[model samples]
Target: MSLPPDIADLLAPKYGLDPSICTGPGLVAATRLRMEINGLDDEFSYYDQLRQSGEELDAFVEELLIPESWFFRDRVPFDFLKSWVTESWLPTAKPEVDVLRVLSLPCAAGQEPYSIAITLLEAGLRPEQFSILSGDLSPRFVEQAREGTYRSIAFRGEDYVEREKYFEDIGEGLIRVRSFVRNLVSFKSMNLVCAEDYADDGPFQLIFCRNVLIYFNDDARRMAFEGLERSLTDDGVLFAGHADAIFRINDDFGRYGPPGAFCYSRRAKSETEDVPDALPKPQSKPLPAIEKRRRFFQTSKVAELPKSKDPVRLPSADSLTEAKRLADSGQLEDAERICRERIDTGPASADACFLLGEILLARKEVADADAQFRRTVYLDKSHRDALFRLALLAEQRGDSREAGNWRRRAANRAQPSTSMTNSPST
Candidate 1:
């Protein structure tokens, strides 16, 4: 099913989404689901509702938002982040700019920003020596990030022993990022596509916008890159996703450090000369000045979501552990039983729902498994593992749009932290 062209037109320019991406089957189904859930009887009514209600529009966009991320996902960048701070940034930082300021745009559910804090700490910078600002387009993600709690699934790198020291294991397979790391970072809800939202935040020394920008069409991509350039200091470093292909945007930045690092430094006459021949250097003419930024998303485009005062409760840790052990030991029935019992006796448990979903999948109850995964997300929006499973389920059922949505959601929550093998040098 194709999304209404009018709706696509409404969303694409506002959020910087590729118009074509809005036409996916999964997205179409999700759109209809939103319409149904909101009591709209037809697409026309849905479009009208969206036009009239910013909260409804945000909900529709939230369905498409990807928040996939995990801690220290791709290790090379963190290694480079630490090195750049200690070896490069510190030596030349002006006395007036004493504190190292970093920004992580689209920080997902806080994994990337927290990872930055940990890297800075590991680099011997005291918490007071550096500050981090993490932002995402989704308010739900920003709130989740501020909570500083996550499932163990959020950690995927081999440095488990080292990273473990910075987390305290809360019950039910969850961990809370230590206060020392959490204190160094501030979280905010922001739309980077809106230049006004971005203009006030930076001139940052280092910026990590990794794994974003691949979702934009040409116009949005250009605008996004220009915004990043405007926010970066003259000599500051900017890290991008490998697939972002920022080199194609313009010669404004030259590759910094090694290839897979996907980092760029503002192109100055001397700096451009050091860039590899693969990226042709610009002529010696002075770079053009930045234009005044434009603001696309306006005040009327947003409405506050009502806050819930209820506290969340999860299944006991021992119950979750036993369920995992039973499932691993080939006793899926017992595991499923324990999960259901937990759900019945306690407040909704995302952990229990996720585990039951896994068990159902193992039992080949695909439809039931999908429902359980959905339930897990309903309980905890930032459950990366559940989102991943939902994506896999969608893909297996040949619903590419649904799979893409789920994958993007999971991808945003996970940071790509490990070194890329056999990647080309920039």
Candidate 2:
């Protein structure tokens, strides 16, 4: 009993989990299971050909593991961690406290754990004072971490001075992490999803598990969070993806964020005695005329465009177009300022409103962009651009039905107006 040739080829080199381990009727089942676990679709067209080439299989596995990450990714989270540790966690530590353990589970090729090491070093902690446990499921990634060498291109256009201070040029366009930073981190191969993988080496103080849980289903997320809770100390904090929220998942953790990123801390025993209100309540008021107009567009099929009044003194249409051009060129803050000034003078200008929404969307201010799009639609129900953008936002939030509806409405409104010619009366 032999496995499918393609399936065997795909799993052999990349996972080092031999497909030949299964025999007889179990081969197909094992192959399908491997595909599912690796998040590969069952119907890959090139599955047959790809299996024969170890290179192709390795490339596919590489794609699955190489998630988007960078040096000091999401800077706000690091800043918050630094302040929280110095102002809150460190002060609470006893003078004789021998070790402060921080873990970066599934640390990938080590960018995140290394970033944590640099942060601790910058905060005046010596390598001996703290230990970073960096673990990953991939043996290849673990080996790479141990090597601590990276292509200079990985630095991108980052500050050259910081790179010089932290990295030793290892030649051939590779730079090695300084020993001081490298020494703080211990690389190990551990599968986070396994129950009995690593011994109880922690009551870890901080765990950076960013961007890993987004791939998980709800059940897997619950299991991962439970594992994290068990691994953490009473006062431990867990940092997740910037876009991910765990507030609805468990009451055991409290969510906090500065300006850009959100994190969770295990709820303290004292918190049970005095539960703080999590969200602010909005004061009730009657909807303004503009808001009412916006709501009407949202709920009603009738298109009602706002009438222009007295040629309102607004920025030239050129300025609005210029702002968009600037924004597309990556001058975001500048574009936002220009659009905001135009909006201040002529609040009903849908073009300006839409431009502002584009800038806000680029900045990841989804809620703000949603409001601006609503306003743009209110001022000009035929604003197809705003409707399309709003539809995209809906799609991003997983509201496919609403997204389709909005897109249909936008398409209807964007249709070319009919023109008529009549013969003169005889």
Relative to the true structure, how large is the alpha-carbon lDDT of every model? 0.70, 0.62
Give the alpha carbon lDDT tens digit for every residue of 1-426 in model 2. Answer: 344565754454334442323232234344455566556675364465355666655544554445545667767677776776566555555545546678897777787898888887777666676888888876788888878888865565555237777888978888888887787889888866552454366657678888665445455667666667667654457777633345546655655434344566644323222222121111122223333443543465532112223323446767776776678777888788777656643324777777777778778877777767766776678887787887888787665766787799888984522111110111
The candidate that achieves the highest TM-score relative to the unseen native structure: 1
Steric collisions counted per model: 25, 0
Error of 2 at 355 (Å): 12
lDDT of 2 at 142: 84
Per-candidate TM-score against the hidden true structure = 0.63, 0.55
Q: Name model 1 segments beyond 4 Å from true.
A: 25-29, 32-48, 93-97, 268-426
Compared to the true structure, candidate 1 yields what TM-score? 0.63
Point to the candidate with the largest lDDT. 1
Q: Which lDDT value does model 1 have at 92?
A: 56
RMSD of 2: 16.9
